[model samples]
Target chain A: MGTELVGGRTVLGTLRSDPPLTLRQTGHGTVHLVSTAAGPLGGDRLELAVDVAPHTTLEIASVASTLVLPGNGESLTVVEARVGAGATLRYAPEPTVLAAGCAHRMVVRLVLEEGASVSWREEIVFGRYGERPGTCHSRFDATIGGVPLLRQEFVVGDPAVDGSPAVYGDARCVGSVLLAGPAFGHPGPGNGGRPGNPRGHASVIAEGCAVLPLAGPGTLVSALAPDAATLRARLTWGLGRS
Target chain B: MDAALLLLADSRLPAGGHGHSGGAEEAVRTGAITGPEDLARFLRGRLTTAGLVAAALAAAACELATAPGAAADQAGTRPDEPAAGAAPESAWRELDAEADARTASPAQRNAARTQGRLLLRSARRIWPSPALDTLAGAVPDGAHHPIALGAVSAAAGCSPHDAALAAAYTSITGPATAAVRLLGLDPVVVHRVLAGLVPDLTSVARTAGARAAWERLPAHAAPALDLLAEQHLRTEVRLFVS
Candidate 1:
């Protein structure tokens, strides 16, 4: 999917879709992902590429939460996005459920131009109801002007690691919202000429949530909760504070 | 194992690592870690996630420090030293930034850099390596702890594998010590827990040292750990700084 600025409004340029990963335009600059089939079942591979042209804005969201189911092998989904100069891209997908006996991997690579900005939000629900969660690996890599801003991967579902106090500590839902670019007015690398301020101050807005300013021009809001609703609420609150 | 590696791994190195719990304090306060069993589980999880990241980074930094032209650049400022080029400086900057990228929580990044700065201060006096000076010049505020450990280890004639081992080992030992102090657990039992993790620790270090590229370092994030770090920062009377 691609977007371009035309006549003072963002318009879709290259809208392509493949089975199980269909794209639907709900409004100008807004696209909703509609999954036609269930189960990114084990062994499934899915990919999505997005391009936001200069001065354009694109917001991509999913209509519902995705459920990962077990199959013959592991499943993979990769999303690569590029935002041009002065462009904005908001990719807010619903929560992902890692069901019992399933294994899944999700990778998102986002690159921004000199003046580009982005808001990327992700939430994960470990297993459904009371069942143990299957393995799910999520990697997000973002860079601006060829300089890395954030590169992280979270691997969950292992009972030993996930249930450890150092990792999950009883939280079942986890999420983060990354807001980057000049729009947020965050201090760039070097923290606006302040030395020794490398650990940008983080504001704890809720019980288990915080909004942290990055060393670069970005802010990350992270939260953990016992339930999906509380997790989303904390993330939303933290985003507002950020 | 080099004696210098053991020295670098010593908890009493005056690196200020004693002030941080590596998220164990927060876990204790939250009732996640009540005894030796919980601490053991937590240490194992941490050894795989944060420990792996630090080990890989230390290995990469050590490799860079021993790179052909790097030694020349570190041989003090000479008129002809410019011929060594900007590679070493740029490489240090990139590695430090990569450390920042991998650390999503501001509190955790701050803690790592704080320990890094202090470690550099002490290592410079003990080892007095030109590489340490080069690293200091590159990242004036401070290099991340793993990077500093790697450079200091190189100055002490240790291999990348040794640096990785020290990095991985400290990731657990520090927290284990903190748990003993905070929870009043039996030191013997905590050491027993650490002993049990020896196999996993070696494997993690081996895996981390095997990675040749800085960009491909392990970035396994533990959301609960990130959350705990942030929360620890907000506690008015916390025992650890992060």
Candidate 2:
């Protein structure tokens, strides 16, 4: 996937679709990920690449929650994105549900150039209703101007560790929103008169959710809840969207 | 392992480590760890995630401190002459920034730096090495705890692997000790839990030490622990600072 700015409007440049994962342009500067196939079943290797050109804005979202089902072996998905200088990328995907007996790995690498900004959100649901989750390893690496911004990986599956208070506690869902760039009060090349609140102070929003301002120009809103609804609600609230 | 490495791992180092519970206090309060078994599970999860990250950082820091020309450069520079220190100073700054990137939570970062500042203070007086002084000059506020530990370990004649071991070991031992204090768990049983974790601890340390590149260090994150660290800070009355 690629985007370019034409006549002060963002336009799609190149979008190559593969099986199971397809991209649809829903509106100007907005794209929705549509899953054409049923399962990213075990042993599947999927990759998605996104590039947003300078001065362009792109918003990518998903149509529905991803269901990871058990299959022959482990499944892997990698999404790599680059936002060029003065560009913006907003990636808000639906929650991924880890079904019982399935093993899935999701890796997202996002690179932002100087003056670029991103609002990336990720959510994970342990399992379907009344079912125990399998294993899911999620890794997110974000870098700005060749420096590390956020590098994190989470593994959820083992009952002992997942249920521990130091991990998931009693929460069946976990989520985080990473807001980085000059738009989020991070010092960059230029703001370009973008409307962004400079108040990036850290604060607790709810019972198990908090907004953490990074040492750099970024903010992370993290939350855990008993269910997907509550998790989304808390994350939304953490982002001040609710 | 060097004997001084044991000193680095000991809880009674006056590095202000006792004031932090590594999220065990929050886990206990949430009833996620109600018994010795639960505590054991929590420690294991932490050892793999946060512990591994810290171990890798410590190992990387130690490797940088002991790299060819680093010692010589540090030896030629005065504590106040950070500009004259050259490569080593920038290297330390980069490692510290990497630590900041790995830590998503402000509260956790604050806790790590607080511990780092105190550890640097004590290490300077005890080991008194040019490398440690260079690190202090590089990061006036503080280096992350793991970075400081690695540099200090080098000054105390410990290898990078030893620094990794110390980091990985302390990550769990501190929480185990806190669990005993917070949940009133049997000290003997907790010790048994720690003893059982030796194999896992060694393996984690080995993996961490094997990686020499600081940019590619382990970045495993425990979401519950991050949330707990933030939530712990908001708690009106809590035993641990983080």
Candidate 3:
């Protein structure tokens, strides 16, 4: 739903959303999504759609943390986006805190054209205060020219499942960074003018998608971390910000 | 059940599986897994997430190989003519990309490709099918492990479901075997943990076989696994490749 501009900058097009979701343009190709309903309530179904034209860039961020309260039914959020050739989208949403008795699922699906690029980040905290976390499932799928580029799914805080070392390894906060496009090449720590940050480990899984993980000090520390602020700061640092 | 599937699932098939621990070595080094209980939990989580993803990819690949016109395309004579369902080369590349997306560590990606290449080498001799040859020609460095497994499974006259079963079983077996060697856990106890997982493995394979399209394949991922794979690569002394 977007087209190329003269300078090859990506501008948002056909931005559509409903209640509890507000949009404010912070800068060119940048918009901040603000929630007005405190947070997603029980049985809430939310959808956000974005279209980035060719030669345009879109940066999206949430105004605050998405706090999931106790709900009678499961809450869901679905995001669908299309990036044209030479377009880019940087999606860095705030941390999501799953409260007790909450069930939430978020699905993000993106379709990219040749030469398109996308950088996305998601942070999840088990609980806000001292309460146990609820069930949460997050899925991400991206395709280029109808071909799959990346696909990932995460399930957290389910009572039926044991705290497997392979899944979370006692980490309460989990953060992920995904960069895909012609612009994002495979760059390790030593190269790319970026010193290696030991706070997180990044790997270029493919030509496009790269993953970074941020956790706490020891096994106990990582598991008992009260919040995601430390992890977020590390993530911001990992993404090359001062 | 196809007898060839047993060969593909065997750890002693000279597929380079023995050299890789599937990140279990790193997990042990970090003290994330110290006993049979922890190992069981780890395997269960891995079986549902990474194992499911691999099973789905293998199933889809097998379906692609056995599709109509696959035999004709295997001749490698028709670079212009598209296959009956999806173009074989593009489809294989797309599947490979999905595999890359699902894997978030450079070490794991390299390990997968290495294993894939080794598997293809053995398959070309044992099965000697045109589909496998064409796939081998397409990705000289090697397709991802699941992609190669599917193609080889089809060549060996196995169904997509059988391929899925093989893929699912191998995902945990590699790491379990590695734990036995690294942690010196009792082999019987280590295998009992695996034996307890038969029902889940069957469920995962069934789910994988249900999906026919590559685009709709499972993307379940454990971020801890990605982290472990990267950490395993940096260790000064390590027993396994990943």
Candidate 4:
């Protein structure tokens, strides 16, 4: 059976995986699900719970992007992504592309409990103009403590505008490059994926256009790419330097 | 009012609106906006996210009448809290505060207020609404464009919602004028683009009123067009102010 557990508040849940990770579905390829029983808040603050046992390595797809939607009710969507001191969570979904007309809000708090390693990505499509249908307006915020950790809000579908003046010139696609880590501590331009650089990097690639890696020192700051080659150079420089 | 729509596009008018391409220049040069479809996309995006700056300001102006102390804030000072008389006025004061807080850009705050002041002066001379007369006397210098537009709209034989329509339309035409100056697209084509885009603005204004009527709040995603605008400000060559 493919199942797992979870937790809340930075994750109040104990996390488990389905199919043991290595055992894939052969045909459909591999799908990894990390379940947790983190306490969720609702009537009485949803206390999230999280539990991740050591020695468990989860295989994840190097997704193109990942997008978080908005809150369901009056409450915000809180997701606690935690990696145990020894446990690793590789979350490389196929760049969870956000469709136009999607206005969501979410809170993603990750707890890398010492020695824990996880690869996470978040991306959004500004649409390829008429080829696409709409835009997305969502907010993503996270914090390790009362201090800020990762706070991002990408609100698409602003009924106010259809396109951005930068890429399209009264055009439609706009990708906000926001990614950060210890590597990009200073407010300098970031390179593309190199490796070992700061492991914290987020990027977005629209169509065949250049893929921009929002690689920086902070989790919320992104270094944008003007073209695909630039994006490649950025990733190469970033990972290479690392 | 359509002439108001036209004047909004006429950067030549001394409204200082010329300084701002309404984000058109930045979006195009930066690659966020391009071409016709891209232009449409850019328009929609601007209207929804960045456009809120104007919409909310317009809405606040429309609601100024009910605010008891609205006159004080309007008197060249930031729109202030309603007077301390009634409970409802106090609620509007809180609403005005939220609107100010949500408008995070200092420059935009200036632009809105600047446009408002001039608009109020012109509108007050042409037509008179008790709301405008009272608020004008209470507020200082050029009131923000929204407050001016909303109040002025009432004075000019229009509704708050109609003011919103005009306010929203202003954002688009400003850029089209830039496109004409920048690209020299045919006169007919420019009008064609306007014709197609106009309905969207009208619809957005109505929807905005409906949404504002409810939560009395609409989405707040003022895309940091200021970044591009800031860059433009530093550039040696630029056609618009913003």
- Best-matching candidate per DockQ: 1
Q: What is the lDDT of residue A16 in candidate 2?
A: 86
Fnat per model, in the order given?
0.66, 0.61, 0.51, 0.17
Order of models, best TM-score first: 1, 2, 3, 4
User: lDDT for model 1, on a 0 to 1 scale?
Assistant: 0.84
Q: Considering summed lDDT, which 10 consecutive residues are worst modelled in model 1 chain A?
A: A191-200
Q: Score the docking of each candidate (DockQ).
A: 0.61, 0.47, 0.35, 0.09
Model 3 CAPRI rating? acceptable
lDDT by residue for model 2 over B93-147, one digit each (tens)? Answer: 7788789889988778878988898999999999898889899988877889999
Whole-model lDDT values for every prediction:
0.84, 0.84, 0.73, 0.45
Q: Which whole-number lDDT from 0 to 100 does residue B59 have in model 3?
A: 85
Candidate 1 regions with alpha-carbon error over 4 angstroms: A185-200, B68-87
lDDT of 4 by residue, B1-242 (tens): 44554443344645456656766776566655546666666666666554544665565555455443543343223344435432232333333333333332334445555666676666666565566666555445445565566666555555456667766777777776676666555767776877887667777687655423212244344334544544444457767766
True contacts kept of 3: 0.51
Give a tens-digit lDDT track for model 1, residues A34-153.
Answer: 999997899999999999999999999999999999998999999999999999999999999999999999999999987898999999999888878999999998888776788888
Who is ahead in TM-score, 3 or 4?
A: 3
Q: Candidate 2 regions off by >4 Å?
A: A186-201, B68-87
Off by over 4 Å in 3: A1-17, A26-29, A159-162, A186-226, B68-87
TM-score (C-alpha, index-matched) for candidate 1? 0.93
What clash pairs does model 2 have? Answer: A186-A217
**Residue B146 displacement (Å), model 4:** 2.6
Give the candidate order by descending DockQ: 1, 2, 3, 4
| TM agreement with the true structure for every prediction | 0.93, 0.91, 0.85, 0.52
